[model samples]
Target: MTSENTIKNQLPDAISARVRSAKLSEGVATLVMDATGLARPQAEALEADLRGALEGAEGVSEVRVAMMADKVKRPIIAVGSGKGGVGKSTLTANLAVSLARAGYKVGVVDADIYGPSQPTLLDPSGQKPKARDKQLIAVDSEFGVKLLSTGHMIEPGKAIAWRGPMTGGALTQMMEADWGDTELLLIDLPPGTGDIQLTMIQKFKPDGAVVVSTPQDLSLIDAARAMDLFRQAHVPIIGLVENMAGYMCPHCGEISDPFGTGGAQAAAGQLEETFLGRIPLAMEIRVSSDTGQPLAAGDTPQGQAFAGIARKVSDWLKAKGSHG
Candidate 1:
C-alpha cells in the first residue's frame, strides 16, 4: 500500500470521528477535523489522537489536525460528606465567600442534588437561575460568588425526591453552567458517597475535595468513607475539616465540645491527609448563614476561621497549579 493510504488506514477512532477529510504530502498528514461544537476536552482528545496515531504511522513524520471549538473547562473542587447535617453546605458557602475576598473568582455548584441548601445559604432571596440554550446561568449572590443549585431551581425548604438519572442530570446542569471567569468552582455535594458523588467523580471530576464531618467517631468514620471515594477516583484530597469542633458560650467564657473534639483531625492524620482546620459550632455562623450573610463576608472571628480554610485551599490550588 502507498504511505498515504497506510497512514489513513491506521487513523484512530477519535480522528476518524472528527476528520471530514484528510490529505498527505511528503511525510506530513493533514486533517480537516469537523469539530463544530466540541468543548476544550474534545479538542484535546483530538490532539491526543493525532499525536498517538500519526506519530507511530509508517512513513508519517508529522501530523496536523485543525479543530474549531469554543469552550474551556475550569477547575472544580468538591466539598462533600458521608452523611447529612455535617455542615458541608455552610462550609462551602463560607469558603466561597472567603476565597472571593482573597481575590479569586470563585463559583459554587450545589451538587447536593437531594438536599441542596446553597441557595438558602448564599442566595436566600429565592432568585431562580436563568438559562440559555439549556445551559444554566449561575445566579448572582450577595456574597460575590456566583451560584447554581437545585435549591435555586426548586422552592425553598422542600425536599428533593429525585432518583438516579434525574439527580445526575440536575447535577450535570449545575456543574456545566456558565460560570464566566470563575477560576475556582466549589461543588457542595450531597451527603453520603452515593450516586451523586459517583456521578461527580466520573463526570464532573473535581480537581480536589475537602471532606467535612463533625468531631465524633461515627461522623469521622463516614467522612473517611467519602474520602476513600475521592481517593479511589484519583481526585486529590485538599484536606479534612473538623466542623463543630468547639462551642463557646455566648453569655459567659466557657468552651464546650458537644460533638467531641479533635476527632476529624486525628482521622485526617491516620488517613495521611491534610487537616484544613476547625470551625467552631457558633451561633453567629448559623444566624449569619440563615440571614443570607455568610460569616466570611464579615471580619468577625467566625469569618476569620473560614478565611483561614479558604487560604489553605487557595494555597493547595496554587501548588497544584493549572492542573488543579
Candidate 2:
C-alpha cells in the first residue's frame, strides 16, 4: 500500500520540487503544488506531469492536485508629469494595455487622488470594486488590465477636496489592495511634486518612474523638476516620454509641431536620461481615449507608438533584472 510518505518519496525530481504538501488516504492522493512565477500553460503542464507520476502508484485510485501560487512582490512603476494636460494619464493607460498585450499581468492604480481618471479611461462600465476581508479588489477592464481608482469610490464629477493626509491614506488603500498575480503596477500619479508624490516616495517606494512631458520648454522644465524629486528619493528614472510631440492634419496630411519637436529628446540627452519614445498628438488617440478604448489595444499607427514605448520599458526592466 502506498502511504503519503511513499508517494512523496516516489515523485520525480521535477514534481517533488514543486509539491508543497501531499496526503494519501483511502486510496486517494491529494497534492498542493507551488506554481510561483509560472504562466498558465506552464502551471497546467506541471499539474499534468504530477498526475502522471502518481496516478499509477500502488493504493492510489484517484489524484487531486491544487496549484497554488505564492504571492510575489510585484514591481511598481510610477508615471508622472510636471503638470496636468500633458497626457500623463493617457500614456499610463495605453502603456498598461500595451504591456498586458505583450504577455504581462499588469495592473494600474490611478493614484491621482484629487483627479482620478483611470476608471474612466480603462473601464467605462463604471464598475465599483468589490471588497473582501477589508481589502479592495481591483476592477477588471476589457483591455486585459486591472484597475483601482478613487473615481470608482466616488460619485461622478464630485470634487475630492482632500487634504494631504487624506489623499495619502487614499493612495495607501489603493496601493495595498489585493492584486493577485500582477507582475507589474503602473501608478498614474498626480502632476507635480506634492504631498501625494512625497507619500509615495517615502512609503510605497516605487522601483522606477517614467516622467512625461510635451516637447515645449515649459513642460520640459516641470518634467525636470519631477525627475529631480525622484532622483532625490534615489528611485531610478526609467526614462522620459515625449507626448503630444506633433500633430498631422486630417485634411492635408501635413505634419506640424504645435508643442515644438525634439525638445524632450534634447532634454533627456542633457540630463543623461533615456528618451524612451515619443507619442504624437493624433485625433484618433483622443477619440479612442474619450470612448474608453485604449489605442494600444489595437494595431493602429497610434497604437504602434505606444507598443514601441512599452518595448523600450520592457527592455529596461529586463536589463535591470527586474522583469520576472
List TM-score per model, in order.
0.78, 0.85
Off by over 4 Å in 1: 1-70
Candidate 1: worst-modelled 10 consecutive residues by lDDT: 34-43
- Evaluated at residue 8, the lDDT of candidate 1 is 60
RMSD of 1: 9.5
Cα displacement (Å) at residue 303, model 1: 0.5
Per-residue CA lDDT of candidate 2, range 165-188, in tens? 899888999898877667899999
C-alpha positional error of residue 260 in candidate 1 after TM-score superposition, expressed in Å: 1.1
TM-score, predicted candidate 2 vs. hidden true structure = 0.85
Report the lDDT tens digits of candidate 1 across residue range 1-324. 554456667876656766667777787888767765453456677678777877857667888877754456678899998889989999999999999998888899888777778877998788988887878888889878999888777667678887799999988888777676677788898898888889989987889999999999999999999999999999999999999989999889799999999999899999999999999999999898788889999999989999999989989988878533
List candidate 2 segments past 4 Å from native: 1-4, 7-18, 21-71
In order, what lDDT does every prediction score? Answer: 0.85, 0.92
Clashes of 1: 0
Model 2 accuracy (lDDT, Cα): 0.92
